[model samples]
Target: MEASKRQETARAPALPWTVRFQIFGLVAAASVAQRLNGTVNRSFFSLVDRHVRASARPDKFGVRSDDVDVDASRGLWARVFKPSEAQSPLPVVVYFHGGGFALLSAASVPYDNMCRRFCRELGAVVLSVNYRLAPEHRYPAAYDDGVDVLGYLEKNRLQDPAVQVDLSACFVAGDSAGGNIAHHVAQRWTAAKSKSIRLAGTILVQPFFGGEERTESERRLEGVAPIVNMRRSDWSWRAFLPEGADRNHRAAHLTSENADLAEGFPPAMVVIGGFDPEKDWQRRYADLLQQKGKAVQVVEFPEAIHGFFLFPKLPDAGNLVKEIKAFMDKSKASASSA
Candidate 1:
């Protein structure tokens, strides 16, 4: 909650220099036009498209899995990752990739790296759901895909003798747009009673839940260099919704109503960026959960900006990972006790 500083040093020339350099340059460029109109968002998406395609790494961070289908109607792409250790029913995390809901896919470098880390570090099975993106798919499309996949796992495979999924310790997580999806999906799961599911928690990193106007932190950090600016946030909302859907619409804000908060809101850990325009909303949502008597852990990286969690090479990134691990550990323990 306190103001802080990021320990930024000259870009390190490291082994994965290509990936690091690309991210470094992109962040630097974004910092320059952080508040530029929609132009910066357009350029950022363009760069993301090119970078995601080129930075795809299928070999490193080895984990094993098969091409599994979650939803056929919307063409949901899924990849399962299981740890190398001999099989035990492993916890499952249904992950949604982030690209402002329109740009990147599951194969995106940052998402791929995250999926790898979750599977390897926690020894949990990860199901990365490549949900349909926006512009072509639009508002409810992403949300629908996310909920449907969770429902599918709950109904069909959670109890399947061969599934290898820890029915008692499952989770839903995503970042950015994916974080938004995780919020909605978790709500739906709780609402439906999802009898077969024993969801542990959700992880939302810098989630977007704006309703028309920017929050206090958003307004104050309007032009913070190397961070997502107000204009870019607006662009993402507009790009992800239907032609007529208003960003200010109550439905657009995940915490628009107490009813949406639901009873037994599963334990959650929401990571926010001090410089993220959406930080205030993220805090508001977490507070709402706490008010509901739900266990909520909020980790705000005061020194970092949006997407800081993606750069694992940076010192801040490494520290963020450690925080994330602690959060996950607590979540898993809470799930077991419940």
Candidate 2:
């Protein structure tokens, strides 16, 4: 009954200069195309994406990754990361990256770095999916890819001595649109009654959810947040949603009073950032899951921005990784007890 009862704002330190420079460049790519049409300038932004490279060798954190094809014909693949010094079968996190469903990939530098952190810190295996983007491969495309990866996990093994994964404690995790996709993926996976992987829980880092009517946070922080503004948010919805569909479509408008979750929907971890305009929607989603009788954990980063988990310069990013580890441990404990 009370959404405003959360933590007060606690501003993290100013972003490092290197991060500021990248943010300014990304803003250029996104801001320039607003005048032309209701679309993103992917060509310009692709330059920034080029630097999101992946390597198969172990990095400083002792995590190594390699890209594995899930379905080459459809350009569906996943970057798999695991600890180099694997001592046991670790939980597998099926990670989907954020780009408003129309941009970025698992190969992106920030995502790659984050996945490595997940592997090294949590002692887990990460399967970061490179699902197809929207305005080209719209609604259900990414969802389909998300589900298919589970099928791949069921039939395939890491086939490497260094990587040992435990599908019994699998998790669907993502940020922004990918978080939305993670929710639906879990929904679809649970609905089908597949025993391929046991979904212990889901981790939604500032999930991107919206409707035709804006929430209070959206109005209050419309331009205050650095990356997202009203224009960009609307454009992302237009590009990702089905042609001619409004924001009220089931995918975007997820917090209806009657939003139907499957009977066995797993527990969830919802991350919120005060500076994110979408913060209210994320809270509504947690409320919805609770109303539906699913267990929920809410983590607050009062002064953080959208996609803050992607950059390590922000203290909240490290804090998020620790929260994820604790959530996973709790989920596994609950599953074992159940």
Candidate 3:
């Protein structure tokens, strides 16, 4: 949490930068092709199983990555990364990781790197939540976990006086499925009139905000190596939703209402990858907010893909880290002046 430590971590040197992404892609493609006869959902899960096993970053802070289990029914687990120094009431960003809701965890290296960088660069308390996955707990479970974490932070305020977090500057963020959760949480906060916990902004990275239907990119990317396919997306939705429920359930998809996404909704910074299948949805969300007279920054990384933020070796990944830091700093400055 010291300034020096944070600086070092933020600019942490490459660990060989040696991930053989191409080989991994080839292996994944072969696996998918082999399982083509099975349900698309199950085929996708085969790749997920490999990813979960391969991505193993050791726990930092002497805290087990899965230390806090908040609820059983909702399967809420959180990993907290506290800044070394709390000079003032610093910001707190609770992040939800991507993977279509059913295929990732708070412990994944890709997300772990992001959580660390956010904590280091912004000097903010960052908590990565591992909400319940699908096929067991679907639909409302993810949204419920997000809301519960906000309440947990408010309830535990008194216990960490030294770790000063500006309640007004607290934010929730996520990528893809996680992004959907972030949006739902912000809406829930507005509905409850939760004045005790204020959010400065919400950040969505390649957020998925649509139903099973295919966009142009999704159609174009069908069976394309290293790009998301509409078929896979359809499978993910089925896994995320409860039996017999539509993926476009009003509460599940944030694009359904202008009222829930009005100007009072938190100012947002949305980062999209030009080639991501969900690019259209990201654009729509940005335009929707701007039309509503809200402050929104849409940053499109031209050469990146859906999970570019996780690919540290890629130049765009570091660029995004820089971009997010700038947004948080400016917000902090404005909050200070106000």
Best-performing candidate as measured by TM-score? 2
For each candidate, the alpha-carbon lDDT, in order, equals: 0.69, 0.84, 0.69
Candidate 1 — what's its lDDT?
0.69
lDDT of 3 by residue, 130-166 (tens): 8887756777888888889888888875245446777
> In model 1, where do residues sit more than 4 Å from their true spots?
1-62, 155-163, 255-259
lDDT of 1 by residue, 96-121 (tens): 87766766667666766667777777
TM-score of 1: 0.80
lDDT at residue 253 of model 1 (Cα atoms): 71
* Alpha-carbon runs more than 4 Å astray in model 3: 1-66, 72-74, 225-227, 251-259
- Per-residue accuracy of model 2 over 1-338 as CA lDDT, tens digit each: 24454223322325688877888787777666443455556777777776455677678777888889999999999999977767678899999999888888898888888888888888888999999987788898999999999889878966667567788899999999999999999999998888768899999999998889888777767656778777788888888898999999999988645477887788999999878889888998999898889999999997688888877888889999999999999999999998
* TM, every model: 0.80, 0.93, 0.80
Angstrom error of the Cα, residue 15, model 2: value is: 4.1
RMSD for all candidates, in order, please: 5.4, 3.0, 8.9
Model 1: pairs clashing at backbone N, Cα or C within 3 Å: 31-226
Residue 17 shift from truth in candidate 1, angstroms: 11
Question: Candidate 2 — which pairs collide?
Answer: 52-109
lDDT leader: 2
